[model samples]
Target chain A: MKETITLKIKDLFEDIGNQATFVGSFFRNIFRNGFEWNELIRQCYLIGLKSLNIVLITGFVLGFVLTLQSLPTLQQFGAEGYVPNMVSISIFREIGPVITSLICAGKIASGIGAELGSMKVTEQIDAMDVSGANPIQYLVVTRILACTFMVPLLVLFADAVSLLGGYVGTSTAGGMTAALYFSKSFSSLVFSDFFPAFIKSIFFGFTIGFVGCYKGFKANKGTESVGIAANSAVVAASVWIIILDAVAVQLTSIFVYNQ
Target chain B: MENVIEIENLKKSFNGSEVLKGISLTVKKGENLVVLGKSGQGKSVTIQCVVGMIEPDEGSIKVLNKEINELDEQELKDIRGRIGFLFQHAALYDSMTVRENLAFPLKRVLKVKDEAEIEQRSVEALEAVGLADAIDKMPSDLSGGQRKRMGLARTLIVKPEIILYDEPTTGLDTITSKEISRLILSIREKYKASSIIITHDMSCARITADRIVIMNDGKCIAEGTYEQLENSSDTFINSFFKI
Candidate 1:
């Protein structure tokens, strides 16, 4: 039992050390000369463009459901006029970014993990490495940067779509006009509310990309490891997103909202 | 003849289990030096160390007069540019077309920005491997033999001085294996490349080997011409040559 516990602790430390080294390499390569702009653009198109429909759909459902769920409680208190305000603040400040990032963790993170894991297993990454090409620069940096750049745009897009959904939900319940609903929604959001959430989304994006790439790149040699990488990427990214969201919420409440 | 690769007392261990136990070998310029070994004997590990993919725990690996372990990243990359490594699985970039696959090393390693030059080299390399018609096809679309040929085309595109093939024929039919062996010989004659081919295929050794080194238990057990090794009275060495 003692030996098993010791081995587990050692493995944990090793994983942490590996992650630290991977992050170091990422930073070193990101600023290196000959940045792969073309590949970055391709990844952006893949990660952002490919993920649009799903993000939109999820965002819309979240806003619609939140508004519907909160309607009766607000109605009981004779505050039906605040439905739009409630939905918008909830979506933009927390729900929009967190839910969108979770969605991205599922879609983008898993995709990168599986792709890179497959590449590693098939020796394609090693081929790139031995061919005098910087696999870290060409593969890891571009994917991470694309994720970092695209995830925020995706969150913003999801936020907008969710507001539209909120408006639709309000209209279906015969609560407000389209123009009135949108105006109320936008009115409730301030700089502090939006900025903190946006910044958190960026962190969430980085976590997703970093975790996914790290898991995939370090995958053990086997066909099964590809699936393991993909699965673990999603799990790790999701956990990191939640943890980051909690920390961001605390920091935002302390600094932004307190002021 | 010049020694392009010299590995002396090379040692590597994974999880305290020693894989390569002080392996020593050399490959001369424009020669096909085949390392014959059964599975799990660290044959692949040796060549991987030569290319500096896996670092050695002890001793030295010198490719083209440069010590592999001593070089920095850029210097290692420079060494790697001069040394082509063809992996066992062919390692064709699955996301790329055959044309793009051939052009990868040319663009990345050679830094050939000229589109026409890239195009010409890609076609020429593919033509050399008889894969000219599969240019636009994805690696997934190619047969196993075609994939190996495509891999060789990619390796040759950079025009490296030394080529290290890790099981150039692992999972092909008998005919395809012979064809690949012949292709290895043709490549040496055409490109004047020094190669270290790691394989257990006796027929491939017979066809492509200028000198053969049989490895077992992480050490080279015997080194000689195929005929010399074939005539050895030792049961262990004769077992390889026997029917």
Candidate 2:
């Protein structure tokens, strides 16, 4: 039993080492290939363009629901006018980034994972290598770069849409005009709220893309591995986003309070 | 004949378990060498090692008369441009049209500047593999045999000096396998390119191989002409043939 335990520990260390090596090589390939502009543009369209509608609808619904749910509470306190400020802070600081990332973790991560995972199972990656193509450069880098750029844009769009929904909800509550709501929301949103959320999203993008690409690239065995990789990509990305968000929040609170 | 690829005493291991143990072989510039092996043999590993996909722990692999194991990743990328591969499944990109699939390596690796030239080559490659009409179709729309042929077309678009076929006839019906074999033969004849085919199909080996290398237990067990292997009284060889 002791020997078995020792062997398991050794195996775990070896696996971690192997993973580190693989990730190191992947990053090296990314630098070596530089950036592929055309591929990046193509992927941006896929990740950003195709995802706009879903992000918009989800963001709007989230904002509207937040406003409606908070209405009863704020009205009871005779602070219904604080609705716009509250909604804006909540959407921009937390809801916008978190919800957008979750949606993206579902959409883009799964898309990338499934696409690359299928390619892997079908041996297209091997085909690329044999054809003198750098599969990592061609596939992984394009995707990671795409998500890195597109996710921010998606977050931006989602924030705008959600704010609009917040305006509609406030107007329906019979106390705020669109103009007044915009002014209140904009005034309440300091750089502290926007920048931290925006910065956290970049990390979220990186995690989503990295985990998705990593799962798919390392996928072995057979076709079943593709499905497993896709599923794991979503799960891993979602978890990483939440973890990163927590770290970001702690870091932001320290810095903001100090300032 | 010029030796395009030479492997000497190659060894590989996965998780400390040896897969290719002291395997060695060579392919002349225009010769088609079919590597015959059962499912778990290291046939695929042999080709991957030659291409530097997996590093061998021991021995020398010289491709195009250069020590492949010694080359940097950039150098390996350059070498990869000169070789093509057909995977077991027709590993086509589901997102791209057949035309785009053929054009992918051409544009990315070859850096073909002229769009017209890229298109012309893609069309020609599609024609070569008998996938001319499926240019606009997605890979998902194609039948299995058509998908395989499309894969062959993508391989040919690069005009590689050597083609590595990994289970080229696996999962195909008998008719499709025959067609693929015929396509492989014609491809060899047309381009005069050397090829290393990994397959368990005896008929494919007989039809396409100039020299046959049989692997068992992670080692090369026999190397001979088709007739020589067939006439051998060795139990393993005889039983393999009977099967």
For model 2 the local lDDT of residue B118 reads: 92
Off by over 4 Å in 1: none
Off by over 4 Å in 2: A1-34
Work out the TM-score per prediction: 0.99, 0.92
CAPRI band of model 2? Answer: medium
Going through the candidates in order, their DockQ values are 0.92, 0.70
True contacts kept of each: 0.95, 0.83
What number of backbone clashes does candidate 1 have, counting pairs of residues 3 or more apart or in separate chains? 0
The residue pairs that clash in candidate 1, if any, are none
Per-residue lDDT over B166-241 for candidate 2, one digit per residue giving the tens place of the 0 to 100 score:
9999988888898999899999999888999998888888889899989998889899899999889998987667
